[model samples]
Target chain A: MNYFSSDFKLGILGGGQLGKMLLAETRKFDIQTYVLDPSDEAPCKIACNHFVQGSLMDFETVYNFGKQVDVLTFEIELVNLEALEKLENEGKKVYPSPKTLKLIQNKGIQKEFYIQNNIPTAPFEKFESLENLKSKIQNLKLPFIWKCTEFGYDGTGVKVVRAISDLENLPNVECIAEEMIAFKNELAVIVVRNVSGEVKTYPVVEMEFHPEANQVEYVICPARIDDKIAQKAQEIALQVSKKFNHVGLLAVEMFQTQNDEILVNEVAPRPHNSGHHTIEASYTSQFENHLRATLNLPLGNCDSKVAGIMVNLVGEENFSGPVVYENIEKIMAINGVTPHIYGKKETRPFRKMGHVTIVNEDMKIARKIAEEVKNSIRVISTK
Target chain B: MNYFSSDFKLGILGGGQLGKMLLAETRKFDIQTYVLDPSDEAPCKIACNHFVQGSLMDFETVYNFGKQVDVLTFEIELVNLEALEKLENEGKKVYPSPKTLKLIQNKGIQKEFYIQNNIPTAPFEKFESLENLKSKIQNLKLPFIWKCTEFGYDGTGVKVVRAISDLENLPNVECIAEEMIAFKNELAVIVVRNVSGEVKTYPVVEMEFHPEANQVEYVICPARIDDKIAQKAQEIALQVSKKFNHVGLLAVEMFQTQNDEILVNEVAPRPHNSGHHTIEASYTSQFENHLRATLNLPLGNCDSKVAGIMVNLVGEENFSGPVVYENIEKIMAINGVTPHIYGKKETRPFRKMGHVTIVNEDMKIARKIAEEVKNSIRVISTK
Candidate 1:
């Protein structure tokens, strides 16, 4: 297709930062793009040729938007899958497919898909309701994890089942109780594949968790682990992409067990935070590669040009108004420090306001600068 | 100044490719910008916060636009100087002030300024009209070059005079008659300075000319000339910037004679086409540094990380209508090939449709890929 500077319009669902960066590539290639998102202040709002502000989860909103473009893709999941499925039936192109999102959107179904594919994962039981789990508490083991099958993300929709009293406070909803397996470390492998069967995987990355929040606090690339283990993670992630017939990027979150085995955790179908380092480290940034794959263009080199460490900027506590990047200029003076502030305008505590990438020839130095970047700039509300 | 995600509105006079690249950095930093361009289909139309369409040379249009912006700057040099001077008098910040532009805008005036400032350049004589030049041709030698004083760019309004009859057919207008120096090569030095007096110069680049057109065919970074000669070029360019008290980027085009002498040709007080290689080759892209210097922010590293070669994508001689980058994918397959298509949907012969930048660790390899890029891609008319 004559996509570059042609009449072919590439439609992107979700006018957030991911879509914003994708639009940069499209702009570079002089490709026409139409972006749909609910927020008028979305980062993609300013860069796209056509900006449609509407609900991404609304059936009519998504269906109408999908029908107008030649090829349809999305930056964020959690859109109306039924609309995409209908669009697919009507001959519209939807990348990653609504079928793929359906299987991955629900945690219980995702785990079952792993089991069916012979993918190693922790054992889990899907309950019809949280009340059913309470009635069978005597028979069920204590100190398990309860995760809502759908609408679960970050640290939400998941709770620790410690005792009988803990079950009383739990919301009565369809969920999964999984046997919390002991893992050495949380890891991730980003696998990229084009429809032409050309596939490549980034090296395994280790995610250090926050002590209190149990969420990823830091992601270190080329994870410090046995080479064999890292290789196993990459191999498994590639197999998953092949099995799912996934096109574009698939970021497979994994676990490294005490036995030195790799286990599947979950997979994100679009560009994930785990691969943010690629912007500064890789010869082709994940943003650029994603565009390449979606456009069916030749993929660029994914090898690291320099060691890059990414520090995400979340809003500070007790701050809840207009966003400000304090000390942004200070870090711009430091070598290898590049800050990207998502033009959100508003900021609430724990909200992702921006990210700073530190790249250097020395990995050690890059990490040190990343830590300094994380400390110096506070994403706070200026009221 | 709370420029990031704030009410700071930056006004840019021209929304051409340079302004588009500059907007990329402004968007990265979340600095709001208002761009005015004659074309509604300008590359920066979607990138900036607000874009006004009006003739940049219109005094009222420029003056009105400047009043709405907190600080004003420009991409193209042919803006209304009176409006800029008026804005400066009214206490608005204007980088590369009207005074600096006055000295650099017209070729005849620029050459005179160099002489007055004790800068070394080939001696030239200014003429009120071309008819007057014919009358004075007896005293002047043959084989000299004639150039229009203003509005000349990219090989237009300039011609070689081998005989007095060459002037007979030429347009009777204000022009410059320069002594054709026996120069072996054309060179350029990009110097970036701020109001704070922090100055930095990118290494001199060699401009390879087309034998027929007498136009720059390729810009080779780290000019093939000796290190001493390159250093001399940079030093002389810095001296020129210092003399102008220039803020932002000043690209000094020069000529190197067979005796290894460097002569100032002219200067451009903006992010120039010559420095486009810095986007992929330099430690900090020229666009980024221009923003820093204009804001009086600390200067960035101007050193090149890789050798870069630039090939201009001019319109094919036989095609003039809709633009088509034929065989663009073929160049994409080559390593270090990055094609930048200026968002002009139309094409015309010898018109600068766009330019491709090839960067690599080795200058020889970059030059080779540049040749491949030049051969493989044709900016033709598809209509």
Candidate 2:
């Protein structure tokens, strides 16, 4: 198909920062794009050829948006799957097909699929509701992890249960309790697959969490791990991609147990925060690779020219109004620093406002600068 | 100035490919931008905050547009100088000040300024008209270069006068005759200066022209020359930047004479095609630095992460209709090859539809793939 500067159009669901970055690639290729977003102030509002302000979960909204484009893909995974299934039945192209999304959308189902495929993972038990798990508390372990089966994003639906009282304030919804294994490090690998079955994997990245907040503070590429462990992480990620037969990017989050064994944690079937550093470090950015995979175009090389590190810029606590990126200029003065603001007009505590990427030939230097960047810039509100 | 996600607006005069690329950086930082261009179908129509379709050379149109922006800059040099001067007089920030632009808007004045600054350049004589030059044809040297004083772009309004008949078809306008000098290579260096006087220079890039068309076919960075020659070119470029006292980017095109001396050819006061490869090769892209310099923000590192080469994609001689990039998929299959297709719907002979950038750690590999890219893709018409 003649996609560049042609009548062909690619439809994207969810117009947040991911869609905004994807638009940069589309603009680079001169490919036409149409975006559907729930917010009028979405960062992608201005960059796309057409933008529809509507709910992604609305059946008619998603179906209509899909019908107008030649090929359809999404940045967020919470779209109306029924509409996608209907469109696919009517001959429209929807990448990461509805069938694949079905198996990955619910946490209980995803974990079960891993176990069925002989994938190594922490042992888990599914409960119909939180109350059902509470009734069997006498039979369960003292410390475990509880996660909601559906509609959870970021850290919203997961928690550690050290005591029975922890379940009292939890919502009475479908849940899963898994044995919490002591791990040496948290790692992630992004695997990309094209419609033609060509696949590639990015290097493993280690996630460093803030001590108090327990949120991801830095994502370091090359993982600073043994070569064998990195290979194991990538191999498992590729196996997961093949079993799901998914098209586009699949970001597999994993854990390195105390004994150095790899365990599958979870997977996000889209561009994840783990790969954001690719924009400045890798040969082809994850956003561009996703676009290429969805379009069935030839995938680009995924090697890094230099070591890279990414730091998330979340809104600080105790402020919630029009946002201000304090000390942004100071950080800009630092070498090899690039900030990507999400164009969000307001900021609430812990809300994602933007991210900064630092890249250098020396991994140690890149990490040092990343810490300086993390300390210098604060996402706050004007209040 | 809170430019990121704030009320601040940046006004750009031309909405061509340069402005389109600049918009990518502005979008990265979430800086609001307004673009003015003569064509409604301009490449930048989709990416900017507000796109105004109007003449860049119209005094009232430019003046009114400048009134709505906090700081104004231009991608093309053919803007109305009076509007910029008026805006500056009224306290609006116009980068690459109108005074600097006045010295550069005309070829005759620009050459004179170079000589007055004691910069090394080829000997040249200015004339009021072509008829006047013809009257002194007996005294002038044969086989000199004839260039119109005003309004020349690309290869237009410039010619080689090898014989008297060569001047018959020339336009009757003010012109200059330059002594032709033997040069080993054509090179360029991009110098960036901020409003606060901070300056940085990109590495020198060598231009390889097409044997038959006399147009630049490839731009190789870190020009395959001795380190001392590269340093000389950079130093000369810096001197030109200082003499111009320009803010934002100044692309200085120069020549390496057979004696190993550098001579100033001319200067462009905005993002130039010579530095397009910086998008993927340099630590900070030229577009990002241009925006930072104009905003008086600190400049980024000017070092390169990898070697880069750029090849221009021009229309084939026989095509003139809806454009089609034939064999584009074949070229995309090559590693580190990226094509930037300008959104020009129609294809005409020699029209610059786009460019392809090839980057790698090995300059030899990059140059080899650049040739494969140049041979594989053809920008032809659909007829």
Candidate 3:
């Protein structure tokens, strides 16, 4: 299709940071885009061709938004699936079809699909509710990972149960108890597939956690791991993409067990945080690749020109109001440092405000600078 | 100054493709921008925070717009200078001060400034009008270059006087006759200076011309020349920047004569086409550095991560209607090929619709693919 500077319109659901980055690509290509977001202050409001302030989960809202565009896709997955399904049934193009989303939306179903397809994963048992799992506590292990089956995002619905009392205040919702494996590292591979079945995989990235906070502090590309392990991670991610038959980007999060075996952890069927560094490091950024995949254009090369590292700029604790990126100028002075601030007016503790990417020919130098960036900048509020 | 996600406003004049690209950096940093352009369908209308439709040369329009912004800059040089001077007089920040622009806004003044500064340049004589030059044609060289002193852009006011007949239909305006020099190559260097006097220079770029059209075909970064010659070009460019005392980016176009001596050709005090490849090849893009310099922030690393080549996407001679990028997909299939389409709906002969940037580790490979891209895509119309 004549998408470049043509009359074609692309509809995007969820006008958050991901959508904001995608809009940069769309603007680069001169492709018209319409964004549907609930927040009036969404980061994407200024860049998109047309922005419709509405609920992404409301059936009518999503349906009407989808009807006005030639092709429909989404940045967030919590959209009204029925609206997309209905739109697809009526001959509208919906990438990563609603059917694929169905299998990946619910944690229990996603894990079960992996097991059914002979995909290696941590063993898990599904419970109808948290209470049901508690009733069988005597038969379960001392400590396990408890996850809600649906509507969990960004560490919200997952918990580690070290004692029975840990489950007392938990919501009585559908849940799963998975046997936790002692993993040495958490890795991610972003797999992109076009509608024509052309596929490519980005290099594996390792997520390094803070010793005290237990939160991811850095995402290092090329994973400082053995070549064999990186290959294994990429191979499993490609397998997941094929099995789901998904169109667009599929970011597969995995674990490297103590014995070096790879296990599937989860997958996000869109541009994920793991690939944010691609904006400055890779030949084609993940956001651009996702747009190409959804539009069925030829995919771009997913190779990196230099080693890259990304650090998230979350709001610091004890401050919550209008946002201020302190010491941003200092980081800007550093070599290969680029900050991307999401235009959110307010910031709460641990809330994602932005991210910084550091890239260099030398991986060691890039890592060292990333640490300096982490120490130099703080996201706080004006109070 | 709390520029990131704050109330700091940056006002930009001329909302064209350059402004559009600058908006990408502003969006990345969450800096508020206000753009003023004459066209309602300007490329930057969608990306800027506030877009005002008004003549850039209108005194009242520019003055009013400048009053609302904390810092003001321009992408195009044809702005109302008196308004900017007024703003600067009132303690407002106007980058590339109006004084520097006065020396550049006219061709004769720029050439005289070069000579006065002891900068090497071609011999030239300024005329009050074309009729006056014709009266003294007997004393001038037979085949000299004639250029209008003011209001000329993009090859519009420049011509070669191979014979007396070639000046028959020339415009009756102040002009300059320059002794043509035998040059081995055309080169450019971008120098960035902040308000606080910090300065940095990008690597010299070589502009290769088409053998037949005599128009630049490719802009190759890290010009494949002797290290000494590149250094000479960079030093000359820095000298020009220091002389101008200009804030923001100054793109100095130069010539490497047959004797290997560099001569100043011209300079642009904003983001220029020669540096577009920096967006993908450099550690920090020219757009980002221009924004940083204007904001008085520290400059970014002016180093390249990979070799880059840029090819302008101009309209075919025979097409003039709604534009269509024919075979754009074919070029996109090539590795490291990225086409940036300016959002100009209509296609006229020789109109700059967009540009394609090819980047790779190997310069030879990048040049080869740039040729493939130039041959594959045709900027035609859907008449």
Residues B1-383 of candidate 1 have per-residue lDDT tens digits of 88888888989999988998898788777789999999988888978999999999999999999999987889989999999999999999999899999888888889999999899898889999987877788878779889999887777788888877677767788998888989988999999998788898988898977664656779989899888998899889989999999899999999999898999988899998788888777767789889888888878778776788989888888899988899987887676777787788888988777788887878898888888888889989877
* Candidate 3 residue-wise lDDT, A1-383, digit = tens: 89988899999999999999999999999999999999999999999999999999999999999999999999988899999999999999999899999998899999999999999899999999988998888888968989999988766788888899889888999999998879999999999999999999999999976543345679999799999999989999999999999999999999999999999999999999899999999999999999999999999999999999999888898999999999999998898999999999899887888999999999999999999999999999999
Ranking by DockQ: 3, 2, 1
Q: Over the stretch A179-205, how does candidate 2's per-residue lDDT look in tens digits?
A: 997999999999999999989999999
TM-score of the second chain in candidate 3 = 0.98
Give the lDDT ranking, best first: 3, 2, 1
Task: For residues B1-383, write the lDDT of model 3, one tens digit per residue.
Answer: 88988999999999999999999999998999999999999999999999999999999999999999999999999999999999999999999899999899999999999999998899999999999999999989979989999888766788888999999999999999999878999999999999999999999999986553445679999899999999999999999999999999999999999999999998999999899999988988899999999999999999999999999988889899999999998898999999999899999977888999999999999999998998889999999
User: What TM-score, over all chains together, does every model reach?
Assistant: 0.95, 0.99, 0.99
lDDT of 2 by residue, B1-383 (tens): 89999999999999999999999999999999999999989999999999999999999999999999999999999999999999999999999899999999899999999999999998999999999999988888988989999888766778888899999999999999998778999999999999999999999999987654556799999789889999999999999999999999999999999999999988999998899999999999999999999999999998899999999998999999999999999988899988998899998988889999999999999988998998899999999
Candidate 2 residue pairs in backbone clash: none
Interface RMSD, candidates in the order listed = 1.3, 0.6, 0.6
Per-model TM-score of chain B: 0.97, 0.98, 0.98
